[model samples]
Target chain A: MLETAVFVIRRDLLLAMRRRSDVLTVLLFFVIVVSLFPLGVGPEPALLRTIAPGVIWVAALLASMLALSRVFAQDYADGTLEQMLLSASPLSVIVAGKVLAHWLMTGLPLVLLAPVLALQFDVPQNFLGELMLSLLLGTPALSLIGTIGAALTLGLRGGGALVALLVLPLYIPVLIIGAGALDAAAAGLGAGAHLLLLGAFLVMAAAFAPWVAAVALRIALE
Target chain B: MLEAIDLQCTRGERTLFSGLDFRLRGGELLRIAGANGSGKTSLLRLLCGLLAPAGGSVRWHGEDIRRLREEYWGRLVYIGHANAIKDDLTAAENLAIACALGGHRVAAGALRSALDQLGIGGSEHRPARVLSQGQRRRVALARLALSEHSPLWILDEPFTALDARAVDIVQEMIASHVARGAAVVYTTHVELEIAVAVALRIDLGAAAV
Candidate 1:
C-alpha cells in the first residue's frame, strides 16, 4: 500500500511538473477570481473585509475543483485507471493517494496562497491564521468529495459540466463551515465549533468518499 | 489456472451474454474472438474483476476470485483497447510508471532494450502522443517486458493499429510468456501466425433471439 501511494504521488507530481502551465493556470485563476471579487464589489476596505471570508472560500473551492478535474480524468482517459483497478493495492489506497495528490497540487497551494489574498481583502491580521487553518481542514473534504464527481464523470459526454454539477452541491456543507470559521474568528467569537465541524466533515468524507469513487469508477469502466 | 463458471452479464435491458464458462491453464493462450459489440470486452472486463459477474464467479487456483480479488488481480495484467500510455511521458518514463503501478520494478536498461526491440528506440525520449498509432501501440506493449511477477495477461484488441512487423513482435512476446508458464488471454480480430499454438478459443457469435 505504501508502495502504491508513493508511486501515485510520484506520478502525480511528475505530470504536474510536465504540464506546468495547468498548475500555474490554477493559481492564476485563484488570483484572478479573488481580484475580480473586489473589483466587482468596489474597493471599500470595510466591505471587502466584511465579505472576505465568503469571497476567499468560494474562490478557493472553485479553484480547487478546477484542479480536481485533472486528477483522475487524465488517468481515466489513458487507461491507467484500469491498470490501477487491476493492481494489487486496494482501491482505498489508490483513492487516498489520489486525494492526497489532489490536495498537494490544489488545496495546499490554495491554503499557502490565501495569506496574500487575505491581505488584498484587508482581512484582519489576527484572522488570517484562522482562515488558513479552516481551509487546511476543509479542502481535503472538498477533494475527497470531488473525487466521486471525477470518478462518476469518467468517460461521460461533457464530463466537465457533470463533474461541476455533481461536486458543487456536496461542497455546500464544507463551505458553510469553512467560511463560517473565518467569519467567527474575525468577529472575535470562538471559531472552534466551526473548525471541529469541518474536521468531522473531513473525517467522514475521507472514510467514505473513496469507496464511492471506486465503485463509480468501476461502473464507468464497465 | 483461471476458470469462469456460469458467468452472466447484462448491459441495462439487454443481456450481453450468460452462462459463459471457460478455463485457461498455465502455458496456454486463450483467444476471445467476437465481432464488434458481441460482449468480448465485457466478458474480459468481468473476468478481470473490473466488472462484476452478475450471476457467477471467476475462480483462480480453486478459490473464488472475488474473495481473493486482490491476490487474483496481483497475478493478472489487463491491457484494454485503449493503449493506456500517457502521451505526456517519454516511452521509458511511461513504462517505468506502469511498472510501479503494476507493482514491479523494471530497470531502466531493461525498459530501453524492450522499447528498442519493439522498434521505439528513435523516439523513446519523445512524448508518446506525437508518435504514430503503431508507435503508441509499441509503447503499450513495452509494459509486458517490465514485470516477471504477473502470470496472466488479458489484452483487448492487442493488434489494433499495428504493422505486420509490430504484429509479429507482439505475437512472439505472447508466445514467450506462455512458454515461460504464464497464461494469456488476448482479444484480436486479425488472424496472424503465433510462435506457439493457441490452447483454447472462445468465439462469441450473434446472440440468439
Candidate 2:
C-alpha cells in the first residue's frame, strides 16, 4: 500500500514537473492575493499587521482550492480514473497519494510564501513564525477537505466554480482556527491551542476524506 | 471461473437489459455483442465490479465480486473505449506506470518489448501527446501484452480505430492468451471477426434469457 502511494506521488510530481506552469499558477495566485491586501488598505502598518493573518490564511485557502480540480479531472477525462479504481491498490490509498502530491504542489508553496508575504504587511517579525506555523498546519487540512469537494463536482458543468462554492463553506473552520493561532500568538498568548485544533483537523481530514472521496469517485464513474 | 447470474441493468429510466446469465470458465472467450445504445459497456463495467447490478450478482470462483473487490480487480485487466493515456508522459513511461498501477511492476525493457510487439517499438521515447490516436490505443492495449499473469481481460471496442495489421496482431495476442487457459470478455461492432473459437456470445439487443 505504501509502495503504491509513493509510486503515485512520484508519478504525479513528475507530471507536475513536465507542466510547470500549472504548479506556478497556484503559487502566483497566493502571492498576488496576499500582496494586494496592503495596497488596498493603504500604508497603515498597524492595520496591515492586524489583518495579516486573515489575509494570508484566506489567500492560502483559495490557492489550495484552486488546484484541487486537477487532482482527478485529468484521470477521469482520459479513462485513467477507471484504471485507478481497478488498481490492486485500494482506491482510497491512491487518492491519499494524489491528494498528498496536490498539497505538495499547491499547499506547501503557500506555507513557504506566507511568512514572506506577511512580512510585506509589516506583521511583527516576532509573529512570523506563528503565521508560518498556522499555514503549515492548516493548508493540508484545506487540501484534504478541498479534495472532497473536487471529487463530488468531478465532470460537472461549471465544476471549477462549483468547487469553490462547495469547498469554501467547508474551509471556514480551518480558516478560523488557523488565523486564530496567529491572533493568539500576536497577542502574547501561546498559539498551542489553535495549532492543536488545526492538527486535529488534519488528522480527521486525513482519516476520512480519502475514503469518502474514493466513494464519491466510484459513484461518479458508475 | 466467472459467472453472472440473472443480472439486470438500467440507464436513467430505460432498462438496458435484465435476467442476463452467462458463465465464463477459464480458457473461455465470451463476446458481448450489441448495437450502439444497448449497454455493452455497462455490462463490461458491471462484470469488472465498476458498476453494481440493479439485481442479481456476479461471482468470481463462486464468491460475490463486490465482497472480493480489489482482490477481484487484481485478477483482471480492463481496457475501456477511452485510451487512458496521459498526454505528457513518453510512451515508455506511460506503459510502465499503467503496469505499476495494475499492481504489476514491469521492467522498462519488458515494457519496451511489449510496445515492440504492438509495432510501436522505437517511438517509446515520444510522449503520448505526439502519438497518433491509433498509437495511443496501442499503448493502452500494450497493458494486455504484459498482463499474462492476469486471468481475465475485459476490453470495450478494442478494434474500433486499429489499422488492419494492428488488428491482426491484437487478435493473435488474444488467441494466445486464451491458449494459455485465461478468459476474455470483449465487445466489438465488428461481426465475429475473431478466428478464436468463441465459447459464448451475449448480444444485448436480444438481451434477456
Interface RMSD of candidate 1, in Å, is: 1.0
What are the runs in model 2 whose C-alpha is more than 4 Å off? B206-209
TM-score of each: 0.94, 0.98
What TM-score quantifies how close candidate 2 is to the native fold?
A: 0.98
> Could you list the CA RMSD of all candidates, in the order they appear?
2.0, 1.6
Instruction: Give the distance in Å from residue A49's predicted Cα in candidate 1 to where it truly belongs.
Output: 1.4
Which regions of candidate 1 are displaced past 4 Å?
A: B207-209
Candidate 1 residue lDDT tens string, B1-209: 89999998887777878899988888898988877878888888888888888788888998888789778888888878888888788888888877777777678788899899888877878998798988988888888766545789998988899998988888888888988899998888897656665568898876533
For each of the candidates, give the backbone clash count: 0, 0
Please give the range of 10 consecutive residues that has the lowest summed lDDT in model 1 chain A: A68-77
Global Cα lDDT for candidate 1: 0.86
lDDT of 1 by residue, A113-163 (tens): 999888888887899889889999998899999999999888888988889
The DockQ leader among the candidates is 2
